[model samples]
Structures are given as structure tokens and as C-alpha cells.
Target: MQLTSTIQKLHERAPRLGKALSLATATGVITGNSIGASIPIWFMGAAKTITGAKIADDTVIKVTNYWINSNNALIDNILPNKDWRINLPDDVHSKGKYLLISNHQSWVDTSIVQYVSEKRLPLTRFFTKFELIYIPVIGQAFYFLDFPMMRRHSKEAVAKNPALQGKDIEEAKRACALLKSKPFTLLNYLEGTRFTKAKHTKQQSPYSHLLKPRAGGLALAINALGEDIDGILDMTIVYPDG
Candidate 1:
């Protein structure tokens, strides 16, 4: 009776104690995912260059599955109170090419999306800022993963050079060509960033759980790779506590 009473008191004082430990566990899982993220990038080029025969697609698939599974496990740990789910179709294997769009709620949203699409679908690749390419090992890994990088210019600079109009699209096309032989999923966050109370109030967003969706990025993606892609996978992620 005494031990049980003490346990109850501790639980009462820190209702979220378990959840906090779970978050730490989730952070560890993401660290594993980050390490897994580097493996393919580390070996693919060196192996291919050494052997003169391109590495088999199966090997790449295995490494990506490890990364995605670790990521999903991380999501499961941190969001224990929430009921998480994934909607996967029967044609996952054949549905190689996809343009995946999702609503972004928090920083965790990207990992959740990647975890959901990793194996059952295809590798999740997205466009990132060109500056991220200089971010030490991770940037080089992104380069290996063939994640597209772009440098955004000021309006005045663009006005000075109208020829830059189609440059972004051209870059996307080049990235698309690099992954043509293998199946892959292209991920795009429709909101483009984490939703905050400040942003929600500023935008006057209609959705209770999301900020206003930007159409330009989606439109650009559709225009560039719409023909090759099977369909758009619309994903929504919600965090009740937030």
C-alpha cells in the first residue's frame, strides 16, 4: 500500500514524465536515422566508381528502409498520446513515382512524412535551400541522396535577370532525371514551414490545425514532374497538444 501510494504521488506530480522520457527516446531514434541517412551517400559513389558497375537498386532500398523505419519509431515515441496512422495503398511497389504533399504542423512533421513513405512507397527527396549544402556532413549526404538544392534570389536580382525565370524548373527537371531509373517519392510541405500561433493569427488561416497553404511550390512540382508521377498523396498531420 505504501509503495503504491508513493508511485501514485509521483505520477500525479509529473503527469507528463513518461512522455518526456519518450521524447528523449524519440531523439535517439532520430539520431539513428541520421546515421542511417549517411550510409547510402557514403558508399554508392565510391562503390560504383571502384567497380564500374552501378550499385543495384535493391541495396539502396535496404538502406533507405532502415532510415525510414528508425524515423517512424521516433515519431511513435514522442507522440505517444496521439493516435498516429498511415494510409498506404496496394500499389505501393508499382507506384514508384509520386508527388507527396503534406500539411506541416511542427518540425517533427518532416520526419513523420519521411517515415510514412520510406519503404512502403519510395525514398523521400525534397528541395532544400542551397545554403544547407554547406552544413557539414549532412549537406554532403543530401547531395548524395540527390536532394535538390536551390538558391533563392531577391526580387530586384530576378528583375535584373529575366533569364532566371525558368532556372528553378530546369533544376527540378535535372533532379528528376537523376532518379528516373529508380522509384522515389517527392515530398513537399504545402505550408512550407511550421505553424505557429503568431503565423496563424497573421495569415488568418481557416484551418484550426494548419496555416495557409502556398500553391506556388505545389504548382511548380506538378508542372515539372506531373506526367511521370503516379498521383499526389495528400497527408495531414495534427498535434493535439500544440
Candidate 2:
């Protein structure tokens, strides 16, 4: 671990070092996640993009999943609590195609999904915005993983331009069609974004801890994938200390 020496030194020199140790570990995790993993993943993804073979794309997906697993392992190492209790179905098959739906909270939700579904679901990919391709590293990685990149058209815009009415769904279908060749899990956050107190109040959400669920995104997924989707996995997550 990169922070091990520094944390030990801080513990030796500082009277109150608990927070310092935690901070160092957190820093290390961030550095390792971004640098130790994402940089290489970016280049590998670029290589995957250049190739025209399905086998190459599958290989890239496997690598990305391994990257997620590595990050999950590191996070577990950094956390003080080792026991995470979540009820996942016993029938969830590793080789089956799945649509995983969950509530979004903090940025940590991605990692939580990766950790919980690691061995249970086929390495999960999330539906991303089409504009995310403009981002540097993460965009490239997501593209390499072949996650469906949705191009959303506003209702008003679609009404004004009749030609664009079903364009978004067609693009989604094209983007998601790649998953048909392999068994994979795609995660969709039903709320469409992270949950927040302001958003909840504004939406007048019915759920106690969740924002109002947006059916449009799920509809897009269903329309795009048709009957290719194997099954659904619904999850509820909570952070007690929040």
C-alpha cells in the first residue's frame, strides 16, 4: 500500500492519528483508483475501440470488470467495518443477462453495486449518457465496456421536430445491441440520478428514503433491449450513519 509508510509515520509522530490514518488510506484509495487503474484501462479501451472483433470487445469487458473488482477489494481494505449485510437473491445466476435496478445515493453507489454483484451478476455495466463520450478517461472506459449511451430528446424538442421522435430509442437500441452476444448485467438507477433532500421535496416523492422513480429510462431500456434481457434484480440500499 502506498499510504502504509506515511500512515505509520503519522501514527508515530502525531498524538491523535486515527483520522490521519483514515485520511491517508482514503487518499491512497483515490490515487490508486484513478491512476493505478483508470490510466491503463483507458489505453486498453482505446485498443478495444480500434479492433472490430467481438472477442476483443468481450476481452475488454472482462478487463474492466477486473478493474472494478480490484477497486472493490481496495475499498473493503480501507473500510473500518468489514461486515456489509445485503440480501441478494440466491437464484441470481452468474452467467445470465440481468437488469439490475437500484437506488442511487452518494458516488459510492457504483462501488456498492460492483461489490455486492461481483460474483453474482455478470459484470455489470450502467446506462450512461451519450455526452459522456466527451469526457477523457471515464468516457473511453465506458465506451469500451459497451454500455448503452442514451441520447435523450426532450419532449418539447421532439414535438417541434417530428423526425427526432423515435431517434433516441433507435440509438439506444443500436448502443445496447452489443450486449446480445454475451451474458451481462446492466444497472439502471430508477430515480435517474442520485437521491437528495431537495430533489425529494421538489418531486414530492412518495418513498420515505428514495426520490421518485423515473419510468422513462426503464422504458427506454425495455424498448431498446426487447426480450433479450433475462431477468431483473431490484436492490434497496441504506447508509445508517447518514
Candidate 3:
């Protein structure tokens, strides 16, 4: 708490330096936590793969929850004061199975999701590109946690190689199947990509603020986990500063 107060006071006295210090602190903490967690995740992930051990999977999720909790603590204690209003149905719980749909805006949106969902909902996982598995700590953690990794093929590529057609959907379904046995909040960004003026203008979006919604991912999730999902929830994030 003292550290938080000191940082806030610094912000009041020197805005730029405080902001820089805050960013550096956040980056260091998150990176350190992720690296520390990933070591165990990698070993357990390998064990799970080799032995099909449920305990290994559970261990990875526990580590991930701790990692997220650490980041959430940073948001609560280290950041400047601001209004962060989150509204959810009373029925939502950490043990519930849910499909969360949200808009895509910025990279920070995922962190916001983590912040809002700390104790209110189950650990959240989103669709990730399969190529991300090659990245260090964070990517490996995502893989071990069973985040649905999709390999999207462009239309041109699919057209040239007909065998690639429908492959992505099949891979996505296989990934989604991994979550059926567990409590999860699967997030789908209906906009497919982050919204930008240039892209929105190019698409001639119908809405004043949002881009066109892609139903494919949501439909895929429904097809794969429809029977297991407790509810489909919609979330809209507004950035007052933007």
C-alpha cells in the first residue's frame, strides 16, 4: 500500500516519470510472474501430453490463475484512481461455464477482461493463433492452459490448396473440445480484428462505432460446446479516454 501511495504521489508531482515508472513496474511484474509460472507449466504440460494426466492440466490452470491474480493486484494497487464499472448478472460464478463475446479494440482489452473477471468468473481463455506457440513464456502458458489455437487460412491460400479447406474449422473444434470438461469463460471477439478508422471505413461498417461482426467463430463455439455451455454473454467495452 505504501508503494502504491508513493507512486500516486509521484504521479501528482511528475506525471511523465510516474507513468514511466508504473509501466516499467507492471511490465517487470507481469514478465517475472509469467516466466516463473511457465517453468512449471512446461513440465506439467509435457507430462499431461505424455500421460494424459488430469492433475497436470489442473496444475497449469492453478498456476495461470495465480499469474492473473498477480496482474489484477497490480491493477488494483499500483494504477491511478479511475472509474472501472463492471456489470454482470448475479448468477455468474467462478464455477459456471460461459461463452463471452466482446468487441476488439486494443491489446489492453484482454488485461481488462482479466481485471474484471478475477473472482467473479472462471479463468478466461480466448482463441489464439497457433503460431503463437513458438513465442516464449506467455505463448507456452497459453498452450498449456488449453486456449483454442486456430490456424486461419486465407481464401486465396485455401483456393490454391483445396485440401486446406475446412481444416481451420476442424482444428478450432478440436481445440474447443478440450474445454468441454472444465469450467471456462471462452472469449470471442466478434469483430475478428481490432477496430480502426481506416479498416472501418474500408468495410463501410453499418454501425457508427463498430466494425462488421463475424459470426463464424461464435457459431463454431456453439457447434462445439453448445451442450456444455451454461450461457452466452455479451460484453461491450467503452474507452472513455478514446
Candidate 4:
């Protein structure tokens, strides 16, 4: 009798659940495409070539800011949610150079962060894997926009090949040096990966709220690009409920 009652309740809710899931998926896809891969290939490519990219000149800064503003408008039109908000300091300026740190939770976190902070900060860029540079359109766009593509060497890999130890950091520094012309934000996720219960249990992490923080990327950014930084933005994003 109890099993039959549970089945009836699930059957009643199935359609509602399915509809909700479908809407969520559609919303995600629209938001992602509106701001991301939908962007044209030659837009930034032409800008880079025209300016010679020797510096973040007037044209480069203008185009970059325009792209960010257009994306923000698209996000507002599509995902108008009151749940997402950012509390930036009163003195935060769009032209200020920032080292931003945040917790990694979902793939969607990047879009959320960019949308919220876009007005108060420069268009944020993260260090991407060096291999992403070869992926055609998106990779070329990232390069033109001054995103640093880094080649990280793990401890085990570095141990066996001593010559590879600091090469990655050196390469990142060389890339970042070109970004001195304009103020920008460099974002890093301290935990390095999204949280999972199974992985958490295996690692036996100490914190109830966060995974263990990794220092490699943070260290390299601070050490290599420290001199130009104006302020550090430590943003803590908390979800409702546990």
C-alpha cells in the first residue's frame, strides 16, 4: 500500500519536474551562447591586427568594453534573476587593476561572476590551459582579449623533469607583461575544482564550507604580476540553504 502511494506521488510530479529541467537547460544554453561562442571570430582578430596589439590602445579598450556591455545587456534580458548580486566596495573603479579570488562551485560561476562584476571592474580574465590556444576561433578571441594561457607543471612531472619546473610560470609572466597598458582583473578560483561529496570524503578536507585551497596559480599570479596590482578583491559567494 505504501509503495503504491509513493508511486502515485512521483507520477504526479514527473511532468512538473521535467518541465522545470527543460526550462533550466534552455536558459543556460541561451545565456552561454549570447555571451560566449556566439561572439564573432574576426571581431577581436581585426582589432588585434589593426592596433598591432603593442598596447591596449584607445581602440582596443573601447572595443573590449563595448563587448562586455553588450553581453551584460543580453544577460539582463534573458536571466533576470534577483538571486544573483555582487557587493563591491564603494571605491572600486573600472580602471583599477584587481586580483580577484573566488570559490569554484559550478561551470556557470564564470558567467555569473562576469555579469555581476562587469560594471564595476574591467572585463575579468582567467589563466586558461595552454592547449586551449589551439582550439581555433574561441582560442584566438581569448588571445586577442589578453587572457593568459598558462602551461602548469604538476609536482610529480616537475620532479622527474627538473628543467620543466619554472618554465610555465616564466611563460605566464611573459604573457602578462604585455597587459601593462590598461588596468584589468585577473580571476583565480582558490579551491581549483568544484565541490563533490565523494571527492571531499576521500580527501578528508578540514573545512565544512570549502575544499582545500591550491596555491600554485595564485602564487604565480601574485609573484609575476604583483607590481601592477592596485587591490585584491576577495569575493565569497554563498548559496541559499546548505
TM-score per candidate: 0.74, 0.82, 0.95, 0.74
Model 2 lDDT, residue 30, Cα: 60
- Evaluate all candidate structures by whole-model CA lDDT and list the values in order: 0.68, 0.77, 0.90, 0.71
**TM-score-sorted candidate list, best first:** 3, 2, 4, 1
Error of 4 at 226 (Å): 2.2
| Model 3 agreement with the true structure over 139-223: per-residue lDDT tens digits | 8778878899989899999899999999988999998999999999999999999999999999999988889999988999999
Q: What residue runs in model 4 are displaced by over 4 Å at the alpha carbon? A: 1-61, 153-163
Model 1 TM-score is 0.74
Expressed as tens digits, the lDDT of each residue in 1-242 for candidate 1 is: 45334434554667588546655666777676777666665676446435634463345546656766766655543443345566676766634788788877677677777666654777788878778878865776566666766667777877999877767767766766666666778788878887788999999999887888887766766766667778788777766656
Model 2: per-residue Cα lDDT at residue 167: 85
True-structure RMSD for candidate 2: 3.7
**Per-candidate alpha-carbon RMSD to the true structure:** 5.1, 3.7, 1.4, 7.9
TM value for model 3: 0.95
lDDT of 2: 0.77
The predicted structure with the larger lDDT, 2 or 4, is 2
Candidate 2 lDDT, tens digit per residue, 149-188?
A: 8788998998999899888778777777878778888888
- Pick the TM-score winner: 3
